[model samples]
Target: MRSGSASSEFSRGLIDRSGYASEKFAEGYDRHRLSPPPAVLKILTLVAQAERPRLVVDLGAGTGLSTRVWAGYAEQIVGIEANARMLKWARRVTQEPNIRYVQAFASNTGLCAGSADLVTCAQAFHWMEPAAVLREAGRILRSGGVFAAYDYDVPPAIHPEIDPAFAVHFAARRRARERLGLQAGSATWPKEQHLERIRESGLFCSAREIVCHGFQEVDAVRVTGLAESLGGPRTIFGEAAPEVEETFVHLREAAERVLANRSWPMVVSYRIRLGVK
Candidate 1:
């Protein structure tokens, strides 16, 4: 499975791994991050031809949020995560009898070959070495089994006035991160190329992309919590650089003013790339 040559590239992901290393970050992430949309289960099952998948493996499974979604749909589910902090929370909050967590790299899950009916990476695929991860996913997926990598768009659409401020906050964070040269620790592939990578891997017989949206009711606290849960933005904001702090304050104030202490419907857009082995 090209494990020998691919081993080095896997470690490159560790440099950026620290982005999610903080216990506080994990806690906020678990509390505020939106769980993957229900459509994921239906689509993966339909494509894999497994109404009830025998086994599902979730790679880069942060806090088991994505893994737990499949508990009722799969006979067994395993979450492979490398971060101790995230894994700790994953174990603590997870109560599904059929689900379990394993600390491991996405490129080397250590699962039995051909044992998984479906393999998924949700909101976490961009941080992985695509080719190496695809190789491991291919090795573990049975013929006709599906491998799907999906992510949601950031700054979920809330209110018109608040959305622009949200964009400003994130853009300011990006600028601060670049100005500080904090980008050296990690590497990431462009999300737009996920479908292309899956198709070019040749391990999959076919590949395709899907678009979906999810809606949830959220209050002002949830809005700010979502902002705080972001890795890069959180780090940049923690520095309390005047401009960035001002941007965050602007967002918070906007949310509070616009929502008026009431819950508002929020929409998150998701992109899913699928491959069939």
Candidate 2:
């Protein structure tokens, strides 16, 4: 495994500087952000079921959305996040007794070595430096402990009528990233490559992807909220773009029009990778 210093430097640049925009988007992150697809929940449930971990550490645990689910099965759940505002909301919103929230970066959790039964990062793995995080996670876990990383793969289509608009939404996001000087990469964000690196690091006894699916019914209001939570259209527009808002409003209105006469379901795909040390 790579030394903590090496991982820390890489992660600090990737997360603290390059990924800083994410923190700005956190306030509105939950609103338009799609829920964890069913596949991810199932995998998480399976991990909790199989491990029945006494102590679980949730890395990059934004707002405790994933941690809340694990809290039921794990004897104790510790959520570590770097963003203070998000951590505050996570602490405020989750009332689970077994769950504790900490403001800390995933690259360096500060927890003692060999103390955790399981370590999981949901939807936030791309934001981390895998080599560093994997090393730290391995150090913090007892023998036979598990480390899991999971994220959703948004399908190409949202809805027949709204599909084009969703395309525009993504286009706007790409433009936003470009404006911020971020490089464009594949949709998967080096996931497979990172998994290979983790395997090569020899920190895990085994590692593989867990497949899962999710379905949800999104109304206009909920969709609007989700968009807002994701940095409010402003993140994409730089300044509020009336045209983008109009597009989202139109999409919502179209959804309403469809729902008034029929039922529509949105399906999401997810991949969860689990590594056991």
Candidate 3:
């Protein structure tokens, strides 16, 4: 595994720079690339019954992880992103003959009307204004097309005590933010309530939910990588700050301590919520 600073071309000191978080986040984003839930493919399989997608659009395609997942199914896939750095990063590392990245916000993709067979947003819907994004999705999707948005929250758990340990660890981070007079990041709409919002958008019919809970066995280093990769703590405290760097070490230590007592493999559990259109 490469160290976080392996890409010296991208400065480690600029994580909070305005309008460039994605680029800043892009530097180390691949080091902690996300794995979507198994249900994601299952949902897409259901969508295949309607018609195997021809053109797919991936909104907020950070580093193109989810976009790559769609590549095999679609002849053409476009990844839309608001951040230039992230777009460049995705194009560089996730390039496929069928995949391309465009600079655009989720709310206004500038795509031709009814051009897409499917739309996907993963781990990024919370960063958007869902109503506007849904409206835009409604515009670009063909009549029978599907729009799916999904996210997984909370650090990967290493069994019974890891989640509790992480709660305490992050709460302390929040308190530190309070001490600095920096506001904590607000919670995004809960997965349950978001269903109602999706239904009310009047975009597409038959709104549905797919929930997945799974665990991955990991070590202390993997835990630390996951912690450092999240943009929240890095953006809030600034990754270059000594305190923020210290928190990563401490978070890893906390995980190690919590998992030592369990004979079971150190497992990180994640819950994924997928909203279908």
Candidate 4:
């Protein structure tokens, strides 16, 4: 295992700079975020040719939502996280003995070299320094190990009207963040470039992308909860702009009207960028 300063070029001090280190944000994230689709685990495990992985590492594992899903699939699971508040919640809720949380940056996890059979970044690759994180992933993955970064499309497919309203809220949140000069908790990258980063890292023998969808039954609360989990409206950065709140209200109203008091099924599209070492 690499240790000390040579372990990573990315600065450890910048871990939680993405403005999502607050207690409220972590709570919202854990409560509302959907777990990674089951196909992601099966695909990565298949590509790695491992029926049951010995070790799996989850990067930027906020609140263990992504990490805990691997408990039955791997012999050991390590969730690497940097935010103290998030880690606290993750530890409190997790019950699997095979799963453990480590407070560490994704690019500098102090895990053994070439030790992981699979490494994943769920809904979190964009907040990392891509090149550095990929290098660390390669270093920790044994030959033939798989690296996957996946994120679900937000807002999901609730209702035609409600979905567009959610988009309005999304745009409003981005505009607010820009106006407030607030950035994510780390150096952010575009999620679309995940496959490119993996292939360009020169560590993977093969790389590809897979798209799949999962369905979940949701109510108005979950709809709003999904929006709130993005750390908007009431984030550590303080209250969002009036327009942001207004747009969110519109989304909520739409959700309430469209779904009424009943739960409806929604489709969550997931994109998985995979690499095999």
Candidate 5:
């Protein structure tokens, strides 16, 4: 199990990582990441009809993947991100006429009060301060507006032969956390727990959930690209520290040996939870 002790310091460290010079991380993630499942649109549409959402705010919008999803539907779509590199990439790559980007933390976005008709966090609630962000969501959203969060549960690998590579990858992650002294201090928790946290916040009414599944294919190149784009975490933790890099390299070599020349299908399962203001 992952730790539940994630702290502000850790979050700050992530915010300071400053992404790659060429924005490789943002590009890779946008390319390989799962598409916004239908449930996200369904929920947004359901709420849009009731509130006639003119302004949609996507917190932790990262590379604008989630922000672009609302382009044609909303009169204006604003993507807020803490990381400058991510916002830069989002601004450069996504050219929607009605979509825009801003650099801001999820916990405290400097948006106008009651300006949003809908708020969303896609695969990013884990990194936020739940109570603070939820309170901020409530502050910015119009009365009776909607808030929704969703994340995909990626099962390392399904192919038996390739599973071993994933095993090594997971072990490396555990070791990396241990080396960083984050095992007991960092906890992303599970996606489902996020829903519970929302309910506990008491900021919204009638919170609900929807489970959606997406299918895709993965090869060595895709998997490696994902690790590279996200970070050297799964394959090779670049220049961070010797111990961390060792663990990453080990996993990379192991995966390299196993996935010499093969590809397999992957099932990406997503759980989307929605609530009303």
Candidate 6:
């Protein structure tokens, strides 16, 4: 198959399988999932306090989790998502009158230039092509508007009992990607090389800030569900990796045991970057 056709097929399969995984795991996401990490919540609150933007744009507003955070503060909040299945779930969960969800990609938001006072991408930055997204974000933001990108970094360690399960899960995912001819690189895409690309775009005032924060007392079941729902594992395993299911079960059981003993908080870290348009 041509590269484009192969990519399209891969993406379609990935999205369809992800929708199934999410549906199977939806309750856990809603009930046990941690709210926005502290750094992300702080950034949103800071923007709300600073700009109280009349019109706010949320790119990659997956399942409306971030959209709900800003719905009360912004006069009007527009959530743009590419995945129809996710947008459907967002519509059902997000009922705020000020929030409107659109089916669109981050590269081309279908929004007018200079129309928004703030544009935010929460926990979904790596999924985007930064150079293209930066230009699009710059176009949609009013002069002096803020652009924020916030995401978390998985700690290098896990609790002793939980660590083995995650190791197996990750190993299976790597094998799956290899089978599909995908490359697994560092958590940061385009690495440090892309920082200059963003700065040189001249779309935003040349300044960068990295805000760090930590989270504890996270529910274990929520963590498991979030990892499984993220599409990486299922995309790779494709029903062949028994270890994936076994690891999740082990993790879930361990979490329950830890929760019963009131010793279940997991330490997590995050970073947030903001610039001016």
| Alpha-carbon RMSD of each model | 2.9, 4.3, 7.4, 2.7, 5.5, 4.8
Clash count for each candidate, listed in order shown = 0, 11, 2, 5, 1, 0
Q: Choose the strongest candidate by lDDT.
A: 1
Q: Any runs in candidate 1 off by more than 4 Å, and if so which?
A: 1-18, 184-187, 236-241
Residue 30 CA error for candidate 2 (Å)?
3.3
Q: Write the per-residue lDDT of candidate 4 for residues 229-275, one digit (tens) a residue.
A: 77433453355477877887899999999898999988999999989
Which regions in candidate 6 have their CA more than 4 angstroms from the true location? 1-34, 37-41, 44-51, 155-168, 182-197, 214-217, 232-236, 261-265
Tens digit of per-residue lDDT, candidate 5, span 42-155: 667686454346899998788888888777677898898877667787888888899988777776677898988889988777767677778888899888888888876543
For candidate 2, write residues 95-148 as lDDT tens digits: 989999877777778889998988888777776767778888999988877788
Q: Candidate 6's residue-wise lDDT over 9-99, tens digit each?
A: 3333444544433553444444443445545655654653554667888886877877777765678899887666567777888879999
Which stretches in model 4 have alpha-carbon errors above 4 Å?
1-19, 185-188, 236-240
Model 5, residue 84: distance off in Å is: 0.7
> Ten-residue segment with the worst summed lDDT in candidate 1?
1-10
Query: What TM-score would every model get versus the actual structure?
Result: 0.91, 0.79, 0.76, 0.91, 0.77, 0.77
List model 3 lDDT by residue over 67-139, tens digit each: 8877666788989876667778888887579998887777777789988877887776655666777888889
Model 1 quality (TM-score): 0.91
Model 2 ranges off by over 4 Å: 1-27, 31-51, 155-158, 182-189, 228-233, 239-250, 260-264
After superposition, candidate 3 runs with Cα above 4 Å error:
1-24, 47-51, 173-192, 214-217, 233-235, 238-247, 256-277
Cα TM-score of candidate 2: 0.79
The models' CA-based lDDT, in order, is: 0.82, 0.66, 0.63, 0.82, 0.68, 0.63
lDDT per residue as tens, model 1, 1-277 = 2232455354444435346775477788888888887876788899999999999999878888899988888999999887777888999999999999987778888899999999999977777778888999999999999999998887789989999999998777767666765442223477888999899999999999988888889999989988867653365345545677888899999999999879988999988899999
